[model samples]
Target: MKKLYSLFIALAGILCFTSCGDDYAYTAPEALDVTKADLYFKAPGGTGSIEVKTDRELQATSSVDWCSVSVSGGVVTAKVVKNESIESRAGTITLNDGVLTSLVAVYQEGFAFGIDASNLKTLNANAADSTSVIVTSSSPYIVNIPSYAASWLSYTADEDGKVTFHFTKNESGAPRGANVTISCDDREKSFTIRQYDINSFVGAWKVSYADGEDLYEEDITITSPSTGALYLNFAPLTPTVTPIFHCTYVNGGLKMANGNAQGRYSSYYLFTLFSSTDGYISWAATYTYSASPYIAEDGTFYMVFANDGSWPNKETNGVALGAFTSATATNAGFVGTLATYTDLVLYK
Candidate 1:
């Protein structure tokens, strides 16, 4: 019995010596290291994360309801909500390891921009009729006006936190258009503006034959009896017969229909004697088709008259006149002169 008890005592002593090898237990230092101290998010909020380089477990929390934080595998991620207001916002993300604490600043941008033109996309051409456009944004924005429109369009900010755009009167006869852009942060919006002056074309215009050996230059008068009816005096083109053309507005220009009874025309021989005064026999005759005429964007006018069968160069006995004297004018040389009358352009 004594030998058994001595062996058991020796084993117990060995176990105690093995468990108490050192006076104090070994413990690692408490530490908390975060990779990032700040985070940023766009207006359309999203997720952002930072790396925690510590050996201890940590808890992450956000100070604001708009920003939420979570920790997984030593990575702290923050989720931000979409900011609808125009004002920017900031929050703090706190990380704790029981003994140490770290902080991360979270910033989010706002998304709000608008342009109020009072539902008007076009403006009148009168210089006295100036207009304004209102702008609304949540953040600072930049206005970009095209180089061609910068001279006529301007903007100003009022003390009441309102942005207003001013437009100068457009004196150009034809319609003018431009696109204005507003930029805030990474987003941009464009608005198109148009100005037109319909009555600007009603005035005396210089006229000349597109194709004729005779040097003919005169002033043609254009009169508008109503909003849609325009009358152009043809006395400059034909001295003998003063045909007046009844035109209507078509696509920002004037157009005359074929065989329009409103337009009265007469041949040089039918109206006046060849040896009467001018000594030149004008072969101006009626036509069948008149091309659509339009005013170009550059304020130039263009008109074209084509022939398709309906030529009135026949004699009293229904015989073709063929060709005449120095005043010889063929079906192609009588009215509108050339196939395309671009040389007879009128300018504003």
Candidate 2:
């Protein structure tokens, strides 16, 4: 019985050894392969295909929303839309056969589309007879005109991406603005046109001033004389007198003139009585600027005032002085009592 048992053990050991040898000699299955691993499409994209050389069932997917992929039998197909941008794009198709994976590179040509409207983003035109603005693009684009603005403006586009806009005379007394849209494929750009009347600055304005130490605000009336200069009653500057300042259009801004330049006020107050407080009379008040002041298109006004020996003056703020304290100090007028008034901005 022992010998029989020994023979049984030997048979079992031989079976184990044979199984181990077979394990060493075995080979894994082949990975997924493709006949064509790369596919290219034109700008007007269409379907592309790659032949799979694997016996296993294959699954395919795309990496980009613009590209899609499918697997049928041993073939992988990719479909893509037209590339409408100036840049070229690429994507990949992933193929998986359970045990191994492969990637099929997909390339598509991009259609050029761009608008060079940076230089012509904003255009200002007078109420003259006619005016035109031109823009260039890489591809032809569609011009979207507002329904209200169609009567005054017209456009023409060429195949080479040259767009021209023609505007007729603006009979409207008020300033008018319009925005035109330029679109190519899914991309869009816009530009604005503003037409101004000759007397656009004739109206009421809200004025604000930053005079270094205090902020003075008031509402003023602006009036223009037929064709030349504009005048506004600025009460905040000259409290007891009829405050009026004049400005002229120059270099797209309203250039201001000093009170003396208008021949209505003196260069120096020269002991003028402006206030009386607690039996004390304040005298010799003057507004002076170191630099020429101007009003910008966006209602921004800038001025630089000279330092009045007592207070520091800035671009937006200026210094003023009370020449005398009372009748006893009349000889000490314009000594050192300086108050500053600076940035005087006006907006409608």
How many residue pairs clash per model?
1, 13
**Which whole-number lDDT from 0 to 100 does residue 15 have in model 1?**
25
Runs of candidate 1 exceeding 4 Å displacement: 1-98, 102-110, 119-121, 159-161, 168-178, 185-188, 192-197, 204-222, 226-348
Q: Pick the candidate with the highest lDDT.
A: 2
Least accurate 10 contiguous residues by lDDT in model 1: 1-10
Estimate the overall C-alpha local distance difference test score of candidate 2.
Answer: 0.54
Query: How does model 1 fare in lDDT?
Result: 0.53
Q: What is the per-residue lDDT of model 2 for residues 24-117, given as tens digits with 9 covering 90 to 100?
A: 3334444466666546766667888877777778898988999988889888878888887657688777788887776666777677555665
Q: Looking at model 2, how many pairs of residues clash? A: 13
RMSD of 2: 16.5
How well does candidate 2 score on lDDT at residue 80?
89
Best by TM-score: 2
Predictions in order: lDDT = 0.53, 0.54
